[model samples]
Target chain A: DQQVKQNSPSLSVQEGRISILNCDYTNSMFDYFLWYKKYPAEGPTFLISISSIKDKNEDGRFTVFLNKSAKHLSLHIVPSQPGDSAVYFCAASARVVTGANNLFFGTGTRLTVIP
Target chain B: EAGVTQFPSHSVIEKGQTVTLRCDPISGHDNLYWYRRVMGKEIKFLLHFVKESKQDESGMPNNRFLAERTGGTYSTLKVQPAELEDSGVYFCASSPGTSGAGEQYFGPGTRLTVT
Candidate 1:
């Protein structure tokens, strides 16, 4: 079963506009969430993250909002640029009693920002 | 400092062959992880190592896949008698410590094709 899901397979936005990507999780035990951006043939790069304790986290042009009650999260990039076009993945991790951490990832959303 | 480094960027071999993928984590990072993505699928975690011991390996698919980390620096994943279904991109990531809040640095990934 896919615990994390990115419903949109692709998205397109104009440069300087806001790009929003959504993700959902079925498991309520997840306590930490992260977003990674990946280019073709390269590994995913960490972009931003939000903890379950907080409703939102912002860094530069990227902002992530979490709604625990809905088991959902969204990433927003304001003034999107062409360099922002890439595959974005959402991942979650639940606190383990044994002190080890592992992440569950979503099937990435491809975002294209037109120049 | 350099990010994670992976060797043998691409490999193609016949079925039933043995292949080994290597990863060198950051100089002082203590956490290591392995992940893989098959065609049109989300990236999935395979294992995690803390220092020299494997902290979690629940994501390992089968006995044919073996992972090792010597001296807690670099890691090697060996797939023996690889099956056609094993064709995928394997990624390696590392973090500083046990903090679930830490960011994970990823390698370029190794693409393996089994014919």
Candidate 2:
């Protein structure tokens, strides 16, 4: 079963507009969420994250909002640029009983920002 | 100050072959993880290591896969008698802290093709 899901397989937005990507999780035990952006043939880079304790987190042009009651989270990039076009993945993890960590990821959403 | 590094960017072999993928984490980082993405599927976690010991390997698919970390600095994943289903991009990630709350740095994945 897919615990994390990204319903949209692809998205397109105009430059300078806001691009929103959504994700949902079926497991209620997940308390931390993260977003990663990946370019072709490259590894994913961390973009932003939100803890279950907070509803939102922002950094530069990226913002992530979490709704625990709905088990959903969204990543918003304002003033999206062509460079922002890539595959975006949403991930979540629960606290480890030991000292290590494991992440569950969603099927990525391919975002295209038109110039 | 380097990110995670993976060796053998791409490999192609016939079925029943043995393949090993390596990962070098950032210096001083104590957490290591392995993930894989098959065709048209979400990236899935394979395992996690803290220091020199495996902390969680619940995601390992079968007995054909083996993972090890030596000296707590680097790791190697070996797939013996690889099957067609093992074709995918394998990624390695590391974090400095012991908690799932820390941000993970990823390496360029190694793409393996089993014919």
Best candidate, DockQ-wise?
A: 1
| Model 2 steric clash pairs | none
Cα-based lDDT for every prediction: 0.94, 0.93
RMSD values for the candidates in order, in angstroms, are 1.1, 1.4
Could you tell me the TM-score of candidate 2?
0.97
Residue ranges of candidate 1 with Cα displaced over 4 Å: A96-98, B98-100
Off by over 4 Å in 2: A96-100, B98-100
Model 1 C-alpha lDDT per residue in residues B6-71, reported as the tens digit of each score: 989999999999999999998899999999999889999999999999999999999999999999
iRMS, all models: 1.0, 1.3
Fraction of true A-B contacts recovered by candidate 2: 0.84
TM values, all candidates: 0.97, 0.97
Q: Over the stretch A1-115, how does candidate 2's per-residue lDDT look in tens digits? A: 9999999999999999999999999988887889999999999999988888999999999999999999999999998999999999999887633333588899999999999
lDDT of 1 at B13: 93
